[model samples]
Target: MAVRTQVKFYYDVLSPYAWFGFEALCRYQKPWDLDLQLRPINLGKIKKESGNISPGPCADVFKGSLFFPDVQRTSEMMELPYKPLKDFEESVFIKGSLPTQKTLAACQILYPDNMEELTRQSWLGLYSHDMDMTDKGNILQFAEAAQIPDVDKLLEFSVGNEAKQQLISNTTEALESKCFGAPWFMVTNPKTGRREKFFGQDRVEMLGWVLGKEYVGHHPSQ
Candidate 1:
């Protein structure tokens, strides 16, 4: 039997590209013999720790102009859903996806088995349903949608030091891996004991090379 490659997928719902990476990697997991670990990190904290204070796309005219259309194109290519909000204020800038990320960290701590579902619900809440993520009620609904047990406890823990610091720790780890963006992958080839890292959503083909698999493209059967 071939050894399973252990992969840590670091993400924040703040980036739609991370969503694409998450979805694509999950699709490749079974065929590629991967043990995918979902680590929901805080992107804002990652940037801050890395001394990266670059302005968002909305702050740049040409980048902002091409943003949503590019998002649509990528979403279509990847067969993913992405309904962007009318403005950045209600979206990524809505507390910088802080509350959602912390809640995801809580999900990781309490229900490691359900982290992916919780993460997906969080991303869909922001990018699909257009929920007001800053509101506790709306954020709670994400867990509910994910079928998380003890959601009240989940929300309670989300504000606690354990979740907050764990998220900070995850952010620190990502930066330590020299990650500059979301969907950063830390891959451990179990057989060779080699540690490798890759960035961006469009990196599955490269990852296939690392894992000794042919690139079948994202959701080829879709």
Candidate 2:
């Protein structure tokens, strides 16, 4: 039997592009036969180390140039929600780290046991509910919406020092893995443990290629 490939998904909530890519991954899960390994890393630290900033003039150029159009095309294709720039509440923290970490802890709480529902609920909480996932109350609310029975314990674990350390460790590992941005996907050979990585939200077809699937081509319409 061929060992299944595990793909690592690193996400930050601030990026709308990441949300689109995540939806694509979820939609194609069974079709692609993937074992997704979700890891949440602090994009703020990554940006500080790399000297990057969000919502600058460069983002405007990028939005007009490639990123926005790419996501728009994919969103249309997948029939998923696409908002160019929603009025998300801005935080002093860089690029939605705290909330993403909380979600990751929640995933850890629910994985291997409630994998399917947890994955669905996580995505819903992320892309649909528009919750400030950084807040404990918001997470508890998401837990309730998901009908996850162990909401309190998950929230407690999410707020603990251990969760902080896990985020740090996950960030360090992603950096060590040579990722410099959000929504990084890596395919690991379960047999040899060799890993190949692709960065950004626009690499969905590339991921399919890595998994030996004929992905539909996507391009921004002129």
Candidate 3:
């Protein structure tokens, strides 16, 4: 039996870059044995701990101005579907930790297999369709759209103390691991006992290199 390389992906829905990274990972064709472990995290808490405030509000006056355009360019370059939310800065705010917490709750019940679809739909719902996932009603609607079973039960569990704690634990674990942002990846080669950390959707090629896979830049033919 071949040993599988493990890739741990830490993400939050607040970051468009994380959404891009998630899409890439989902479409990635494994050239070698691999296992992905997806962990939902709260980027706001990570930013608070790292003293990094979001630049979205003041992006026009700062280097942050380049952020969104760059993301757009990257998405185009990679041929990934992307549609920026209307009134992006004003519309896309995390009301609370409820969104991330709900992700963790869903993971607890449907993880190790169902998370990718859940996350993909969630991202598309928020960014592309302008769905307000922060609201419970919207979340249930999203669950229904994604075909997640037991919507009522999941929503109840999501707001429970255990789900909150799980989100906290994941956030703490991410911070302790020196993660300061979303779309963080930790790749481990069990056979060689080697591990590497990568941040950003841009690091996908580097990750491929680490995994001993050829980095084929995006092509129109693909």
Residue-wise lDDT of candidate 3 within 99-118, one digit each (tens)? Answer: 64565555655543656667
Q: Per-model C-alpha lDDT, please?
A: 0.84, 0.63, 0.72
State in Å the error of residue 87, model 1: 1.5
What are the RMSD figures for all models against the true structure? 1.7, 4.5, 2.4
Residue by residue across 168-205, what tens digits does model 1's lDDT show?
A: 88888898888877879999988689998998889989
Those runs of model 3 whose alpha carbons end farther than 4 Å from true positions after fitting are 55-60, 94-97, 218-221
Question: Can you list the residue pairs that collide in candidate 1?
Answer: none
Cα-based TM-score, every candidate = 0.93, 0.77, 0.88
- Residue range 114-158, candidate 2, lDDT tens digits: 434454455556555555556667666666766666767766677
For candidate 3, the 10 contiguous residues with the lowest summed lDDT are 92-101
lDDT of predicted model 2: 0.63
Q: Better model by lDDT, 1 or 3? A: 1
Task: Select the stronger candidate by lDDT from 2 and 3.
Answer: 3
